[model samples]
Target chain A: MGRRNDHSRQEIREMALQVAEKIVAKEGLQGLNARKIASAIGYSVGSLYIVFENLDDLILQVNARSLDQLYTVISKTEQQCRQPDACLLALGQAYLEFAMEQPQRWRTVFEYQRTKDAEIPSWYRKKIFRLFKLVEKPLLEFMPTLEPHLCAQTARALWGGVHGICILALTGRLEIVGADSVQNLMELLITNYLAGLKNVQGTPCTPEEGTTQECKA
Target chain B: MGRRNDHSRQEIREMALQVAEKIVAKEGLQGLNARKIASAIGYSVGSLYIVFENLDDLILQVNARSLDQLYTVISKTEQQCRQPDACLLALGQAYLEFAMEQPQRWRTVFEYQRTKDAEIPSWYRKKIFRLFKLVEKPLLEFMPTLEPHLCAQTARALWGGVHGICILALTGRLEIVGADSVQNLMELLITNYLAGLKNVQGTPCTPEEGTTQECKA
Candidate 1:
C-alpha cells in the first residue's frame, strides 16, 4: 500500500491508465472509477487526483490511447493494400475487427461524454482529426477532383457509416438486418459508398466499367 | 398524494413512464431509477415493481415508446413526400430533427443495454422490426426489382448510416468534418447511398443522370 512513493509521477500515470483500461475492458465504462484505479494501483484517491483533473479527464486519456491504437491499426492497412478502395475496405475490416476484439474499450471512445458545454480538448480533437486523415489520404487519391473540404467531409461520412455498422452489429441491433456477417456488410457499405462517390464526381473508371481491373474483386 | 388511489393500474403505469421519460430526457439514462420515479409519482417503489419488473423493464418500455414515436415521425414523412427518394430524405431529416430535439431520450434508445446475454424481449424486438419496416417500405418502392432480402439489408444499412451521422453530430464529433450542417450531411448520405443502390441494381434512372427530375437538389 505504501509503494506509491516508489514510482515517479509519469510511471504512476502510465500504470493508472493501464489498470483503468483493464477494468474498462473487463467491466465496461460503468465499472471504471477513481477509487478502483487507485486501489488497484495501491495508491490513495488523493494521489490519483494529483495526476488527472477528474474522472472525465482520466477517461479522456484512456480514450485518447484507444484512438491512437485504432489509428495504428488503420494505418497498417494502408501498406497492405495498393488501391485506395482496397485500402478503405481493409481499414473498415480492421476497424470492425478492433471493435469486435475490444468491444468495451472501443465503445468507451464514443460513449464517454463530458459535460454538455465543455469543449472537446484540442489534443483529443487532434487525434480524431489524425484518424480522419487516414481515411482522407486515400479518398483524395480516389477522387482527385474532390474539393479539399469535400474530401474531408466524405471521409467522415464514410467512416461514420462504418462505425455505425460496427455499433449496431456489436450491440445486437444488427440482427434485424438478417444473416449477413458484419464483414460482408462492411464490404457492401464501402463498395456502394465508393461507387456513389465516383458517380458523384463523374469519374470515368466506374466499378461496373471494369470490375476486375478497376475495382477490387 | 391524495390522487394516488384515484387512478387505475394502467393510468399509474402510464404516469410512471411519462415521469421516467422526463428524468431520462433531462438528465440521461444514468439519472433514471425506481426510487426517483416512485418519488416523483408519489408512490412507493413497490408500486413501480407492480407495473414494471425492474429498472431495465421500465427502460425497455420507455425505449419501446420512443421507438413508436420515432416510427410515427418517420411515417408522417411518407405522406409529405410522394417520391420514394424524397420520402427517404424526409425520413432522414425528420430523424435528425428528432435526435437533436430529444438528444438524451433518443440516445437512450440505442445506449441502454440489458444485462449480458439476456435476449431482447420479443415485444421490443417487434417494435424494432416495425421501425425497420418503415424504412423498408419506401426502399422497396424505390427499387422494385431488388430482392426482398436485399431490400431489408439495404434499408438497415442506409438507416444505420443515418443513425451514425446523428450519433457523431450530436456528440459534437462532427465538428472535424467542417462547415456542413447535419442536414447537409444527411442529404449527402441518403443521396449517395441511394445512388449506389441504383447503380448496384443497374437501374435505368440514376440520380446523376437526371439530377433535377429524378433526385432532390
Candidate 2:
C-alpha cells in the first residue's frame, strides 16, 4: 500500500468509488467487495474503511453517483421535446436506454438493500428526490391547478410505471408475455399514462375512480 | 440421514422445495443454499442434487410455485369483478397485497438469476404466461377490436407497471417521494392505464401515438 500521506482524502475517496464502479460494471453487484476494491486501487482495506463507514456506506455513495448520472440523462430530455407529454416520453426512452447501457450499475442503485431497520441516509434520499423533480416539472405544467402533494404523487405513480417496465424488460420477465422491445413497452406506458392525465382535465363526466374509492374507504 | 429407500424421488423433490421456500421466505434469496435446504429437510446434500440439477434448479422450481400461487391470487379477482376495468383494478390490488404479504417469495421470483445462457425451463415459462393470461382476458374484453398481438403487448405493458410499483414500494425506495400507500399508487396505475386504453377506443381523433410511431419507424 502507498504511504498514507501520499494522496489527499478526496483523491482516495474518488479513486475507491471509481474502482468500485468498475467492478460492478464488469461483474454484477455480487462481485463487489472491499478486498477487491482495495487491491484494485492500490490501498489497504484499512484505508478504504477510513474513507467510508462500511460496505453499505460505500454502496450508498456509488448509488448516489448513479442517481446523479441518471438525473443528468433524464434532464436532457427536457430540451429535446416541446410538449410536456413528448418530454415525458423522451425521458422514459432515456431511462430505458440508460438501464440497457449500464445494466449492472443501474441495477445496483435499486438492488442494494439496507438492513431491515436501517434508514436510508438523507443525502442519498435527496439525490433520488432530485430525479423525481425532473418529472414533476413537466407534470405540473400539464395540470396547473393540481395540488402540490397530488403533483408529487402523480409524478411518482407515472415514473414508477416507467421504472417498472424497465425492470421487467431488463430482467427478462417481460418474455413471459411476448413483449417485443423495451422501447415499445415504454412508449406504450408513457403515451397511455399521459393520455389518462389529459382525460382528467378534459372531462368531468368520468370521475377519478381511484380517488373516489379512496375517499369512500 | 434417513435410509435412501425411505422416500421416493417425487417425495424428496416435494420436501426439498418446501424447505427451500421456507428459507427464502424467512431470509430472502441470499440466505438460501442447498446445504441449508437439505439440513432443514433432514436429507443429505447428495439427495438434493439427485432431485434437482443444482441450487439454480431448486430456485427455479420454488419460483415456479410462487408464480403459480400468484396466478391463483390474480385469477380469483376475475370472479369478484364483472366489469373489465373493475376486474383489472381488483387484480392490481391482489397483486399488491400478495407482494406485501409475501415480500420474499414474490421478490425471489424476480431476483433469482440463472447463469447467463441457461434457458429458463419451459415449465417455468408456462406458469408465468398463465399469470399474463389473466390480465389479457380483461384487456381483450375491453378492446375487442385490438389485434391479438397488441392485446398481449398491452397486457404486458400494464402489468409491468403494476409490478414495478410493488417492487419500489416493498423495497422502501418509494419513501423518497413520501408515497402514501401501495394500494393508492397501484390504484392510480391501473386507473390511468385503463383510462388511456378507453380513450384509444372512444376517440378516433387522438391517434394511438405509441402504435402510430411504431408503424412509422
Candidate 3:
C-alpha cells in the first residue's frame, strides 16, 4: 500500500481524491480527515497540501467528480426516453436510483459545506448548472412557449424537489412517513408538478394571488 | 452560566439541552461535542450520562424541541390563512422562514444521525407524522376526492420538495443556481405541483401510461 515517492504530484492528487471519495462513501463525510486520506494514499500530510490547497480543496475535488457522475447519469437517462414527459420521469428515476445506490457520495455533493470566502469556481458552477440544463431541455421540449426565465425557475424547482426526495430517502426520514418506494414519491412529484405547470395558460401567476412578492418573482 | 451545583436532576437535563442547542445553533452540528456541552453547563462528563442516556438522547431532545417550534409556526400560519390552498402556501412560506432564520437548528432535526440500534421512539415518530398531517389536511381540503393513500403520498412529495429547496438555500448551493428567493422557489413548486394534480381528470394516470408501478402507487 505504501507507494510513497513513486507517484507524481498530479498522480498523488488523483489518488487522494479516490481515497477521499472511498472514505466518504464508507463512513459518510464524518470519516474524511486529512490524516486518514493522506495516510491511505501513501503520502505525508505535507504532500497532500502540496497537491491541494487543504482538506476542503480535496473534498471539493471529490464532490466535483460526483457531480460529473450525476450529470452523466442524468444525460444518459434523458437520451434513452422518447417523450420529453417520459424523459422527465426517467431523469427523476435515474436521480433517485443514483442516490439510493451511492447514497453517501450523492449526498456529499449537497452536504459538504465549503469554507467562507472560498468561492465555488466558475467551472464547478457550470457543472451544477449543466445538471439544471439537462432538466431544462426536456422541460422546454415538453412546453414550447414557456418563458425563458420561467423555464429556468421550473428546472430549479423541479430538480430541487427531486433532490429533496432523495435526501429524505437516504436519511431514513421517509421510512417514518411510510413512504415505501422512493420511486412513487418521485413519480408523484414529477407527474403532479408537470401537470400543474401545463395548467397555467401563459404565465404561472394568477391575478388573485398577486399579493405575494413571489407572484412577480 | 455556572449553576451546576444548585440545579436539580431535571434542571441539569434542561440546562444541558439548552447549551447543546445553543452550540448547534451557532456552530452547527459540527461544533457539538459532549465535553463542550458538559463544560458549558458546568458539569462533568460523567454527570451528563447520569442525566441523559447518552449524547444521542440529548440531541434527540433538542431536535424534538425544534419540531415543536416548527409545529407552532406552521399551525399559526395555517390558522391565519383562510383557504386550504392559501394555507398550504403559508405553511411552505413559514417553513422556509423558520429554516432561513434558524438554519442549523432546523437542519439538525434532519441531519443528526442517531446510533445504529437506536429506534426513534413512538413520540418522535408521532411528531414527524404530525408535520405530514398538517400538510395532508390542506391537500385533502383542497381536493376531497383524492384517495387516502394518494393524499399521504402527495403530502410527502410536496413537503419533500419544499425541504429540498430549504436545504439548498441554507447550504448556499442555491446561490450557484442564481436563485434569489427561497419563497419564490417554494411558491413555484407549490403552484405548479398543485395545478398538475388538478389537471388529472379523475385518477392521476393516463390510460397509455399504465406500465409504471407508481401509476397505481
Alpha carbon lDDT at A167, candidate 3: 93
Tens digits of per-residue lDDT for model 2, B73-177? 778887788778888889888998899999999988887778788898787778877888888998888778667778888888888899889899887778756
Q: Identify the runs in model 3 with alpha carbons over 4 angstroms from their true place.
A: A1-8, A43-47, A202-205, A211-217, B1-8, B33-47, B201-205, B211-217
Per-residue lDDT of candidate 1, residues A1-217 (tens digit): 3375998888889889999999999999999999999999999889999999888889999999999999888789877887787788888889988999999999888877786666677898889888888888988888897778777777877888888888888877787445366765666677667777777557344553122112321
Instruction: For residues B66-150, write the lDDT of model 1, one tens digit per residue.
Output: 9888888877887787778778888888988899998999989987878776678777888888877888888888888777777
TM-score of 1: 0.85
The local distance difference test score of each candidate is 0.79, 0.81, 0.84
DockQ of 1: 0.23
Clashing pairs in 1: none
The model with the greater DockQ, 2 or 3, is 3
Q: Write the per-residue lDDT of candidate 2 for residues A104-148, one digit (tens) a residue.
A: 999888878875677787887788778888888888887676678
Query: Per-residue alpha-carbon lDDT of model 3 for B1-217, expressed as tens digits?
Result: 6565888899899988889989999998889999998888889999999999998998999999999989988788876777777889989888988998999899899988899979989999888889888999989988887878888888898989999998988888788887757777887888788777777635444556542333575
lDDT of 3: 0.84
Candidate 2 docking classification:
medium
Interface RMSD of each: 8.0, 2.3, 2.5
